[model samples]
Target: MERPRRGWEIPGDHVVCMYKIIVTPNASVRGVASKVIRYASIGEKEARQKQEYERFNAEIISWYETSKRVGLVMISYPPEMFDAKYGGIASLLSVIAGWNVSMNEILRVKLLDVFLPEKITKEFEGPRWSPDKIRRKLRTGGEQNCFLRVPIYPRLAYPEDYEHRIKCLLKKAPEIAPDIIADSELLFNHEFCSIDKRIDIMSKFNKHVESMMDAKERVETKTGCKTLFFINVSGKPSYTLEKTEAVKEAGLDGITLNVLTTGFSLLEDLRSKFKNLIIYARANAHALLTRGNSVGISFDVLAKLFKIAGADIIYTGAPCGSLDRVKPLDDHVADIRHRNTIVRNPIYNIEPALPSISGGVHLGNLQVNILLAGVPLQITVGDGIYNFPWARNNLDRIADVIRLFKKAIYIITQRKENMWDDHEFRELRHKKCRTYFMEEGKCVDPTDKEIKDVLRRWVYPEFRDVLEKWERGK
Candidate 1:
């Protein structure tokens, strides 16, 4: 699935948009290659003939390397999306054919991957975590992502000069696993404690962690999620420990910690204390990826490393949305996960964790997102859902979008259980899904597999294509 590139503007309702991506099909399967063409659906073979068709068994890898566009992939959206004022899908073809757009000139890049809630570049727009509402809106039984996010802001503000605001932030968390994204102020606030090897009760942050333990019951009841809070623990570690311990005691599930900024041992300590806590590992060194370093571990490897350090999940920025979309960088993400398989570190016995797709994810990229993130995707949308100008009932709409995404995932991935696999969450995805939305008191069957197929082919794709075209450059 593709994440929107930065600098490429968009609108909430508009359907079609032009997308540019760099793909190294050579590293695709060995890296991010989604499917093998030799063994493809019958109709897919015919479609392959129409566009750029590589040798059937000669390998898609060859086309990836030899094409003068040599990994350059630019596609136009559905034709209906075009107009004289705003060119349609075909216009994109014309632009690429006539214009010479350089990778360096593009400001944003969308990193395509399987998980939501991954890391994002600072440049990518509202794709940034707003400390507001965003993400999937589940309204039917079909739509359900194991993790359902609820927005909870810092209820109390710390004095500008106060040293303990970070302490206060951790203190306020009712629960911590759904994953929290705070502004930088909350991330590096001097008042926040560091991760400590030994848990302490006397520390102000420690006290907050202990306090949240009591509040856990209330939080669990309120969100109906047992371990669903990711606190603002972006500061350094020993103090990060107090935050981790607070997470442990409060039964809060995770915290977003910058892995590159802190050592792996910090995560190790937190993992040691709480066997089940989820850590959202953030890595900032991914900037090197766009330059085409296939061997370096890159940010994707950081996910593997963090998992070794005890992170439950890691954030990989998007090719677009909150960051510029760079095709080469997207290839690097695939390389990190596929090519650089993490060797088990002697530091600890660890399992393969999940990668998150963060930055500017919203209702718009649903299908392409699943395609890009791969199955079992975890995407974070800070403003995409909340920032809608035409949305009438924003809350319900968000939930509806979430539900649609879940249903879409189910349909697209062809999996029945485990909406969130790595975390192994089961019932959580069900929370957002309602089997039916009433129409005249009669249950409407919107999700019967047959009807769903009809809608996807006959409806959704067309409509999505239509609006996306005009959304470009918005």
Candidate 2:
């Protein structure tokens, strides 16, 4: 048997990186990664912490079966999926999903004013989902999206509060591994970066980071389960490579990385160097858009392009996790992970994709998210895991979420029997966002030329000088 090895690399103009996803027998233990990870009792605690996760699991299953509710569906396009909150247009959705209001009783609004891509608009050509369509889609699983988000802000506790809070954060990894580890500050403007530069937070920050890293090590050491861990280096790119190395050193099984946080040259350099890190291009490409929703590359196109550029994975979106873009989300994920058909065997691994089902993931939505993903999915969770009320700590909830999530991933990955009847299964798979084909021709997939333009025309040319300096160690 070949021992699986993972690495990253850049092939000339293309940033090419590859890593394997293992489905090992011992992989199910929540924190005990006895094989791929080993670290000191870096942070003291027996491998027994995973036992507490039993509590984490129970609370979550209870929530899902009980209080979870349907939230509103916001509809507004925003550039940069990783940046600021999408349009303030989420009131309806917030009221619905956050508040759990039913859609049928709500009033519907028809509009005459409009702005949309010509190609896309032509398909709908002046159509919006009538309430009936929306209801049908929702009921039929044709369209429904939800999200659970955890924004990894810097340790916000006051200097006095830091120790205990940090300890709490570190100690609970097993009980509360989240769906989406923002692994980064969800929102940081240029001003914050400048502030980081002026202050000496770098060293102190690492100490905090190390504590979390140590916690991760303990979890992997004990439970052996590897849930998605989004490590956002965008917070500090200079430290990113090293931090990523630390993550691997700590024995983390997977990570989420953002291409926007660092220059292409830096990413190229990372690909060439570590090769072990599984890079997930974060956010919408920063170079590509503005308030004008027109003229933008689709996340699907970007994922494929980045894969070609050496990214091994991409977070496409949840079933419209935050805003209800299920139809489109479904299409994007399918387009990315068509998997190995008997005939294709290996279909170029085009986007080298992981349609990371992310967005607002929470306790209430776990099973629904499982159903939405249809199997073989990476369910990224965040707030749902961290924000648990202490008596009912969120960590246990996270454990349960992962258990359910992995159950889905495992079954799908194994080609298990479809538990849903054909009619129900087809209905779930037939999400509406994927139906954008007005022209009778099979739509052509994205071309790498557009990616090249973004790279060469927008980012690389400016990035060359710094890269050269870094390469030469000047």
Candidate 3:
């Protein structure tokens, strides 16, 4: 049988928005060539006969050529040029980013931004579960005064080459429990550890699936808190989908998708197919992030695009913790999540996509991360808990780490005078409380440098060894 169509395809008749982008030429070009063809006519002899066929559709809005290496050109197009029905992500891209990439020799035309119309955004089913729903589902503990849903995702590994890591975590669940346990993104791709080629992915993943279910049981029985377990489904598109189907059939909670590895178009396709499965889109900085450098796409644009494409949770970079000098990126991501009205497409009542702050997040700067990322955020940490030097041998000590981190988050979010004003964490607070705060349906602005400095100061110095290891490996 013919292979099933991998996903959605861009048809020729889809309706699109009046999209525009700025194109910068590699070298200065003549004015005639700079304009994108809109109503080109062939030679006089064939012009009459081929009038209908010869019209190349696109309008050049503006052009600025300052020098040989630097020049800017703006292009606009009518919505009728795109195939609206079958073109979800791919169709939209064909107009915005698809063709211009290959034209680098003549001009470095990059997509600075697009003003998407309501007609286009309405086609997507944005996040199925909002931040509040996710918080209720996972039940990361806090009070009314406490910022309710700052969920945590802790990356895991099978240390003993068995299901020992998860089992240990479940046994310690009575004391400390993580909101979500996630497989390392590289694990599914065989980069973290080599698996026997003979073993099918289902067989390799079966034990983890069972272990996650077992952990769920223990958490419910002991702590009464809910937990979500997401397995990394990373690989070629077809293979990843196969794994996803197996996980869904097995009753696992979700899948962690490295969107960079799978392709953004594929991610949207999966979202359409697996409506119930929670998809965590991790922008691993391998694909879109690198491509974004050449184009003008920043983390902010990428995050909002993923949301429009129906991603539930997106990995929105780390600021001042493990990765350095990305505070602006993080702030813009949070802005998209909380202030969806400002940055999102206007047609749909799309719930704000949850922005997850990852990369070296731990108990030390956990409070800082939560504050900076804003409430209703998701926090992901790996080495911070697993490789804690003091708890290297004792798995039970993870409870203390969770307890302390939650305590810190609660104190900072609630701003309880008695709890932190005179406490040790008092020093962790910014002298001016520089954080994203709600005001008139928007986040109050704070300089990226100020937030970065305060968060850096709050980082736990004890984890220097772990941070050093991450830097070296990176």
Index of the highest-lDDT prediction:
3
Cα lDDT of model 3 by residue, 1-474, tens digit: 221121111233222221123345443443433433322222334644665744435556555555455444445545555554577767776655554334444434444445455556667766766666666565544432222121222333333532445454544443345566666666764544332221233244445534665666624322225546676777888888877887676666677887766777778778888887788887776344424333445444466667777777776554425553433654444433333322222224556666676666655455445544554456676666665543466765655555555555555444422223334434433332223112121121222455544434432343333333322422
Note the Cα lDDT for every prediction shown: 0.36, 0.33, 0.51
Off by over 4 Å in 2: 1-182, 185-230, 235-256, 284-294, 323-351, 387-474
Q: Show the lowest summed lDDT stretch of 10 residues, model 1.
A: 114-123
lDDT for each residue of candidate 2 in 316-368, tens digit (9 for 90 to 100): 55442463243444343343233211111112322223445556664334433
lDDT-superior candidate, 1 or 3: 3
TM-score of 1: 0.42
Clashing pairs in 3: 13-83, 14-82, 14-83, 14-84, 15-84
User: Which candidate wins on TM-score?
Assistant: 3
Higher-TM-score candidate among 2 and 3?
A: 3
Q: For residue 460, what is the lDDT in candidate 3?
A: 38
Clash statistics: count for each candidate? 89, 45, 5
Candidate 1 vs candidate 2: the TM-score winner is 1
